[model samples]
Target: MYTISDYLLDLLNYLNVKDVLGVPGDYNLSFLDHITRRSDMKWRGNMNELNAAYMADGYARQNGMAVLVTTFGVGELSAVNGLSGSQAEKVPVLEIVGTPTLAAQYDQKLIHHSLGDGNFEHFQNVHKELGFKVEAITKDDAISEINQVVKYVYENKQPGYLALPVDLTEMPVNPIFKQLIPSLFRNKNEPHDHLQNIEAISNQLKNSHHPILIIGEDVQRFHLQDVVRNFIINNDIPFADMIESKGIIDETLPQFIGTYNGSLSKDLTNQLINKSDLILLLGAILTDANTGGFTQSFNSQNTIDINAKRINFYSKIINYNEQNGFVNLIKIISQTSLSQSFPKGPHDSINNKLPVPSDKPITQDFYTSAMSNFIQSDDTVIAEQGTSLFALEQIKFPANVKFICQPLWSSIGFSFPATLGSQLANPKRRNVLSIGEGSLLMTIQEMGFAVKYDLKPIIFVIDNHGYSVERVIHGMHEPYNDVPALNYSLIPEAFGAKKNQYNYFDVRTEKELLMAMKSIENNSSQLSIVRVSMAASDAPEDLKEFGKIIAKQNKG
Candidate 1:
């Protein structure tokens, strides 16, 4: 009695998905029963579709891939922004959209979740436009379509869409298709001219005096951190990570330089990067944010850009069809004899000193420095796009710390929900969420989800009164940048967290902030929210400069 719903669940379960994230609607109610009944997978319903999608994105970042379920039309539309961010950041997320029944669609009936004009395909078309590998499933093609969509999303590391009709949930699948097999089409052979490209890259590395490796998010996505680290250590080459790829490799490594933003980078990092004779960009994408608004200056001829599908050495391009091309390249390069001597840049030793308790209010600089001291190794740190992210740029993370943020997408309200997913994916590690008041307000409902799941996360609500990121970009004094004031400390209790389950602190000064941190450390089993107040004009120096560049770009 294996049904279509069972087949999908089994496949996802085989992929190691322990939870399915979504917001239930009438169209998806029948399928939700299957998820609820399954002992291997639990249905984690979010307050809305957007947060569910964000949670899926975060889960995929930590757990390799994630599944997002939503109802058609309105529900799917609400999740589009989060899916787009996943697509932009190249995270693997499979979106299952429960649509109107096949009979209603065949008869062209106007449904509640469909367009008023009786067009059921409209929403599926929308997802396709956003680069999702979309397919509307029918009874006849359910198994094949499901497998195809999942395989595509898993292989490409991008979002995929499946429009599942409500009627198909209980349909019995053929006995022959009951045994779901892994994709047989995966090509494990080396790409064309793989050795040639590897040799060319090796020759370049061997001849160059000072070659630096610029690691990026793709390294983490492809699970090449160990091989990349081996290459770095074996060659004695200095390396720096981009914002999107921060903490992919251990930042505490002595050979690890600093974060390499274009002009906003530290003086030593900028100098070392600029002086390099050859730059090996392994799995690194040069997005505007990663390159400090595209201000990075390096000689094109001396750079070798290696990504998943293509290898660009100087201007000569070699396209590879295999997905493991990047993996193979790094592995072979790690084995090559290309040792080079380079001076290690001055590493920022982790400062463990707590701020001396004072009546003085905490400033942005003071808070950022303190946070650098507070974060421990192996903790997952999720920062919002605004002040939280900019402040994080100053901190040198401890070894094995997983840093999560939407730097490439620059979306506000993403971190809060993302923290929930990351924590659920790896419940053993402590999750720290640093978000501005403005960003948190957008997805504040997710706090209830965290409480309902009994997860313990230390949340820092940086209350600067309003949208400080927008103020620095433009309209420093404009009313449009202001957000409605809310008492953030009362949110956890309102979200159904009992007194014993959580702790809340309102800290305005350095002394108060330190006290709140100490209390949270003592009660590590309970959820803690520390709301720190700061001036609206105060921000990290890097953020102020980056904002001005963005403002200029927007004006043009």
Candidate 2:
């Protein structure tokens, strides 16, 4: 007769989980001890539970399956913030919460730190807001319950949960669970009139000019990137992505029009999409923020949406499952195709050409060059928000290169630990992150993880001061983005980074930037933070009119 904890271990193996991200405390020591000894599952070290959750979110976004573990109360709550961020972004994360063992949960007297009745009702109920499936695991139901949880999270593309009481962590395996095998399918929720909407969308596409296409993160989840890219290329439509939709096309493609959201250009793309008689929005949801609150930017004759859910658009709502309701529409477009005017290879179009390297003082183009010069085609790109966002928007990704950016939530300080997880996920791939100095301090301790394991990634800190996005939008733009610049070169020595394994440099001009980058090549096991100055500037177009109207109304 195996104990409950042992059965839980077997269940994790069944689900093929290789690592769990979280921190260990006294409450979870036994459980951590059990998993730590097992070769099959390893613990991803975390400096903070919040970053751990973000790391799990990134890992989920990357590997499609991410599991996070944390202690009860504060630990679990620390992780909820990131979990919520993940849920909002539609990333799937499995949160394994360690509860106070049943043997000690009854607080006969005042406990060291109990948030509630020790039942963790608040903890479990929090998922209702987070929109993820939550379950409390008992010693007896370890295998069956855990298996079911894993299957649901995988199918739904949302976070999953397993609340572990300390007692269950060390319990033996369940004999009955050994016979259980979980199915990976999710319960389908069909829209009321899905097929009719598809028919209507087909009617719209059949009568159009300049019919462009877009595929979002959902396509990536379905492993349909190749399918969608082929369809777009065959149709010869210039394409763009929501932040999460990077890599759907070779971003380097001539026909690929980059992302179409905050900080992304709305110039030619906005004009083309608005001018298009038909827009086929496949896998892309019409989120207000993504579409500037679905404002006047959309002037197309018809907007046909294909998504995981039936979304109302152009008086028609379409919901399709794996092209089940979409085949009829595809066939119609397959017949009246006119994309042959577009070429197969990359762009020769002058408007779409990469911006010429300019000496223009303080532009995203400047930092993009600094990064591109250092970034080997073989290296992976891990981007953070703010100036890093600006820099990467223009950087062309290389072959065998994967770019990691948390653009969905665009949460600050996101790239630090996420880079750590990326390194762990693919050891051979080098890590590089561009972060705002203020954002980096949110969880600067994560750099310690690099020190502990000596997992070196070249870190470029865009020391553009505090909250660049906020200042530009609301308050004074300049002086506001300014924060004290620390000599980041001492980071290696301060963090116990391997001796001679790291270097630090600051760059404000063209020559110094080039020299610093040249020094980093062939370096190993090092943390290099290249500090780039931040000069305040306006967004592509200020929303002053929009902001003014709202403010005036609020005052009224």
Candidate 3:
């Protein structure tokens, strides 16, 4: 009596996907039933699809591939922001779409959020355009397609698809279905025992007067923490990260520098890295946000880029290179007889480090420091776009802890829903959310999902009115820049949270915030929202300059 729904559960279980973030509807009810009836997979309900997708992304970033399930039309459209972001950031995601039965899909009748002109292929089209491998399911193809879709997305580190046909839910299982196994493919970047480019890199590291290493999420994606740390410690190379990639090394290491996410080594760090004769980059993408649009004083000296694909050392820009496995290069670098005496920052004697909190209004450095102390060693941090990004850049976490954000897309509304995934993935791990007020309102309904699961997190709502980041960039000081905000504390009530279980803290003054934060230590685990207030005058110092540049570029 086993059906496609049962096989689907088995597929999810095989991927170790115990949690799914999504909304259930008529089209997807059979799948939902399977989730409810089965013991292997657990469901974290969401009020909308966007939140579901984001939660899935957050969970995937931490635990593994996240399962995001949704119904057709409105449900599919609702999740576009998060799914597209996962695609942009190279997160492996398993997105399951529940389509109308094979017959009603192209009906000319007006349906909500559907491309009613009979283009039922819109969902698949959107997925393809966004770089996700899509599969439109028919009753006949259900077994084979589901198996293949899961395998491709799992191994490729990309978003993938499964468009389910409702009719397949009730179809009788065939004995031949057991033969549908996942297809395996090997990566071109696989490592070997020895490599020439790696040997050259080893030589460079050995000869260099000062060499620093930069890494990003790619290290985590490739699971090279041990290799990265060993290389750094063995070579005595100073290292820094691009916000989300912090904590790859033991922060206690003397050579471990603070974040370079937006700071861009500007005053001291820029000079240190740029002035270096040799720089080894391990799994860093060097995006505009991390390098401040690559305007690190316009250095002409070549940087050695050692990513998963290639290894290259250069006098200026990319020079001698090999497009092979960085793992092998790292191994070669680790064994090399490199000098251990690397130069330190000129300001190493100074107290200038990542911003520690003060008894003042919220600043990125201060906020992150406080948050770092607030969360336990294993707590998960789910971040959204804007000033929160700056805060995440400042706090250092343990190697096992994770910070999830939709950086590639940098979309709002992710932090709120992503918490659902984090909670579902590891029930014991504390989940904390960092999001701006504008971002929270985008998918505020997802808060109900939190209450439903009783998944508690201290959600810090950075309440600075509307679109703070955009305002900082554009300098559009008009009424349009402000958002219509409600009482931030009332959100929990509106989201169906019970009074006894919900906690609200409005932090306007420093003293109040300190008190609220202290109270958090006593609450075992509660979904508390601490609203942080900011003045219009407050912004990142570099952000003001960015706004001026935008104004100058627009000048007539």
Task: Output the worst ten-in-a-row residue range by lDDT, candidate 2.
Answer: 343-352
Q: Give the TM-score of candidate 2.
A: 0.83
Better of 2 and 3 by lDDT: 3
Give the true-structure RMSD of model 2: 4.6
Q: Which candidate has the highest lDDT of all?
A: 1
Query: In order, how many clashes per candidate?
Result: 0, 10, 5
Per-residue lDDT of 165-220 in model 1, one digit per residue for the tens?
88988989865554635443355776545888888889988898888889988899
Instruction: Write candidate 2's Cα lDDT for 287-315 as tens digits.
Output: 64355434535543366666555454675
RMSD of each: 1.7, 4.6, 4.1
Question: Is 1 or 2 the stronger prediction by TM-score?
Answer: 1
Best by TM-score: 1
- TM-score of candidate 1 against the unseen true structure: 0.97
Against the correct fold, how does model 3 do in TM-score?
Answer: 0.86
Query: lDDT tens digits, residues 511-545, model 3?
Result: 66667888877885777888988665565555455
